[model samples]
Target: MSERTTFQDQPHRTVLLRNGTVHSPADPFATAMVVENGHIAWVGSEGAADSFADGVDEVVNLEGALVTPAFTDAHVHTTATGLALTGLDLTGVRTLADALERVRAYAAARPADRVLLGHGWDASTWPEQRPPSRRELDEATGGRALYLTRADVHSAVVTTALLDLVPRAREISGYAADAPLTGPAHHAVRAAAYDSVTPAQRAEAQRAALARAASLGIGSLHECAGPEISSADDLTALLALAAQEAGPRVTGYWAEAITSVEGAARVRELGAIGAAGDLFVDGSLGSHTAWLCEPYADLADGAGQRGVCHLDAGAIAAHVIACTEAGIQAGFHAIGDAALSAVVEGVRTAADKLGLARVRAARHRVEHAEMLSPELIAAFAELALTASVQPAFDAAWGGDDAMYARRLGPERARTLNPYAALLRAGVPLALGSDSPVTPLDPWGTVRAAAFHRTPEHRVSVRAAFTAHTRGGWRAIGRDDAGVLVPGAPADYALWRTGDLVVQVPDTRVANWSTDPRSGTPGLPELTPGGPLPLCLRTVVGGHTVYAGPNE
Candidate 1:
C-alpha cells in the first residue's frame, strides 16, 4: 500500500504531459497540459512546457494515450456490485443445470461455518425460464447451502435448510402464501440474508467493488435503494468501504421510496453527507411490470400489468415537493411509459404546486426514463427531468435483432436507448452502468451510446463521453467533475490507442466504428483485453489512489 503523502512530499509537482493532444472539451483542443497540485494549471503546445521547466518536478510522456475526464456511473448499487464481484458468478449460466453445477462447486470449497451466498443469475435471460426454487437450491448446495438472489436483486432462491436458519424467511413480504418462498417475500429473505453478513464482511465486499471501479477508472457512483427497504445503514456500510485511506472517491444517491415530508427530512439529512434520494415510480421492463400505455407485444395478457404505483397521484406529487422543499434533490425510477408519465405528472404537479421557478431550482430528476411515447419526449424537457440511463444495457442486449426486440417487439424496440433523441430534445442525458445489471466500463458504455443497435439513434463519441463524464456529475448537481479545465478536480483516465485520430476526431460528427466482432485496430486501443484495459493510474481530488503496474 502507498503511504498517504502530501503534494509537496511527492516527487511530481509541476508535471508536464507534453505533445499529447488535450481534449479540454471547453476548448477545441490543446497540444499539451500542465498539472500543478492536482489541477490543470495550463493547457497549450509543447513549447508552453519550457516556461515552467524551471519549476517542473517530473515529466511524463503521453505515449499517445487519450486523456479524458474519468467516468462516473450516476446510478449504481455499490455494495451489491461489490459482493457480486467476489461471489460465485452464475451471471452467464445458461441452464438451471449450469447454475447448479457452479453453486455445488462453490459450496464444496466453503467451510461449514460459512454461509454461502451468490448473485448474477437472471431467469429472464435463461433458456429454462422462471426463477429456481428452494428444492433446486438445496440439491445444488448439497445439504448446507444458502444460495440467494439472481441478477435482478429483487428476488432470490434459498435452500430449505438456509430458510430454516432464518426463520422469518418462512413468511416474507412478496412470497406467495401457499409457497415456502416466492415474490417479494423471497426478496425480503434475500435482504435479510445480506444483513446476516457481518459489517467486516460487508466492508470487504465494498472494498473489492471500489478496487474494481478504480481499475476501470470510475471515479464516482450513485448508490440507489429504497428508504425502509434499502435503509441508510446500507449506504453507511458502503461509504465505510469507500472511506478507506486508499480508494477512489464516491458520491451516493440514497433511493428512498417514502412519500412523507418526514421521510424527505431524513433523506435531506443524508444529503448533508453527499447522498441523494431515489424513488421508484414503476418496476423494471424485464419483470414486465413497467407502467406502459399499451400492452407488451409479446405478453398478450391484455395491457399486461399496469405496473406498481406504490403512491397515488397526489402522494407522488407530495413526495417530489417534500424532497425539494427539504433542500434535497430526488430521482424517480420510471422504466415504463406509464411510469414515466406518472413521474412527469408528479414532477409537474410538484412544480406547479410549489412554483415552477422554484422547482427547477431544486433540480429534481427522473431515473431510468427508458420507455416513453414520442409525445413525452418534450415533456421530459418541459418537466426538466434528467434521464439516468444505463448505456451498457444496450451494448449487451440491444444488438441488432436481439433480446430487446424479442421482449418489446419492433416498434417499441426502436426506443431501447434513445440517446440522440433525448439529447436533441434538451433532456439532460446521464450515463450509468447500473453495475450487477451490466459491467461498469466507460469505453464499452461509450461504444454502446455512439454505436446504437439502431444507427439513427446513435450519438457522437464526444456526446457519449460527455454523458458518461460531465453529464453524470451534472446528474448529481455538481459541475466540479468531467473537465480538464483549470480549478477542476484532478481526475482523468489515460487510454493507450494506436491512433488517436478515431477517438479524438477533428470534426464533431458521430463516427461509427467497425463492428466489435471484427478485429479492428481501434477496439484494441480502448479494450486492451487482458486485465480490463489497465487503468494506468487513478487520481481523485489531486491524490493518487490507484496506480496500475503499466504506469
Candidate 2:
C-alpha cells in the first residue's frame, strides 16, 4: 500500500482537468474542472477552459474519463472489515466442507496467533444448510481457539476452546450448545475474539480497510462502533489513523444509548460524531434474531420465536430525546418489522417531547431499516430521519428461493428494503456496504438498488448514486460536500468507464430523461451483469489517496 500525502504537507497548486465528462450540477455538459486549495474552484465546458489555461499551474488531459463525487459508505465496521480483507475471508465459500478446510489451513498457517478470527460464512447457502458444529470446528482447528462469524455478523459459531474465554457465554440469552451464539452470548464471544488482537495488528487492519475503501472510490466512512460491537480504544485508534493519514475520512459513532447530558458528553469525549450507528434495537434476520412482528417461517418453534429485541421503545425514546437535547445525532440498527416499529414509535415520542422541528434538525438516522411499513415510512419522513441502508442485502438474500424467503416467507420478504416508497414519502436515503456483512463494492450497491429483485422497490440509477454520495454527507449533517460543484470540497474519483447514459427503473419516465436535451448528467452503465466502472484515481480534499495501476 502507498503512503497518503496530506494536503497541508504539499504546496498548493492550481490544476485544470479538461477533456473529461465532469458530473457536476453547475453545468451538465461540463468537460473541465479546476481544483485549488483543497476545494473545487470551477467547473465548465472545454470551450471556456482557454480563459484560465495559462493561469493554472498544471493541466492534464483526461482522455475521456468520468469525474464524479466520491462515495461515502454510511455504515461500516472498520477494524472488522480490515481483518476480513487481510485474514481468512469465507465470503463466497460454497460448502461447509470447504469452510472447514480453509479454517484448518488458516489455523495451521498462523499457529502463533492467540485467537483464530474469520468472517462471512452463510450456512444458508451451503449444501448442508447449516454452520459447522462445535466438534467439526474443533477437529478442523485441532482444538484451537477459533471464532467465526456468520455473514450477517449478528451471530457466530465458536469452538469450545474459544467459548472458554467467556465463561458466562453459555448462560447468556440466545446461547445453544449445538447452535450458533446470538444476543449477549454473541457479543461476549465477539469481544473476546477482538480483544485477543494486538495493537499492531489492529492498526494494520484499520489501514488496510481504509486503503481498500479509497481504491473503490469511497472517500468517507461512517464507522459503527460501540461497547458491545467494539471497544472505545478501537474507535479512537481508527479515528486517529484516519486523521493522520490522507485517506478516506472516518466519522465514528459510538452506539451506546444515552438518557442524560453526561451520558451524551461521554460519547462526545470518545471522539464520536454521535451516540448513533449500530445501537442495536434487534439482531439480524439470517440469524433468526431480528425482532419481528411475526414468527419466522422456518423456525420449528414458530409460536414463540419472533427473534430478539435488545432495546425497547422506552429506551429508544430516552436516547433520542437526550441526543436531540445535546444537539447530536442518534441512530439505531433495526432490521425486522417489530424493531423498525419500535424505532418509529420511540422517535415519535421524542419528537413530541422536544418540538418536532428541533428533533428533525438533529437528523437522527436508522441503520438497516429493511422492513418498513407505509406508516413507518411516513414517520421517517415526518421526523426527517435518514435511512442508512445497504442495498447489497437484498441482492444477496432476496428473491423467492433465497434465504429471506426461507426465513420470512416470500410475502414478507418482498416488503423488505422499500427504497422507492421511502423516496416517495420524502425520507432521506444513504447507501452503504456494511462491510464484512457485505463487501465494499459501491457500484455493485448502486446496481442492486436500481435493479431490485422486487421491481416495485427499485429506484433510479441517478437516485441510487446520489444516495451513495450526497445522501451520505447529508446524513452526517453536512450539505456542502459530496458533490462536484464549485465551492464544494474537492472529494472525487476519476473512473475508466463504458458508455455513459441515464438509466431509470420506471419505463414511463425513462423516455424523457434519457433524451440528451434533459440536461441530466450521466453515470456509467450499471446493468446487473455488466462491467462496473473502474476507479482510476480517488482524491480527498485535493490529495490523491489512491492511484490506479495506469495512474
Instruction: Name the best candidate (by lDDT).
Output: 2
Which consecutive 10 residues in model 2 have the weakest lDDT in total? 1-10
TM-score of each: 0.87, 0.97
Model 2 off-target regions past 4 Å?
1-10, 301-304, 507-514
Q: 16-43, model 2: which lDDT tens digit per residue?
A: 9999999998999999999998899999
lDDT of each: 0.67, 0.93
TM-score of 1: 0.87
**Any idea how many clashes model 1 has?**
6
Can you give the lDDT of residue 315 in candidate 2?
96
Error of 2 at 53 (Å): 2.1
Q: Candidate 1, which segments miss by more than 4 Å at Cα?
A: 1-14, 112-114, 145-147, 165-173, 176-183, 228-230, 258-262, 271-278, 300-304, 399-401, 502-534
- Over 412-479, each residue of candidate 1 has an lDDT whose tens digit, in order, gives 87876677789889888888887777877877877777667777677766677788889988877887
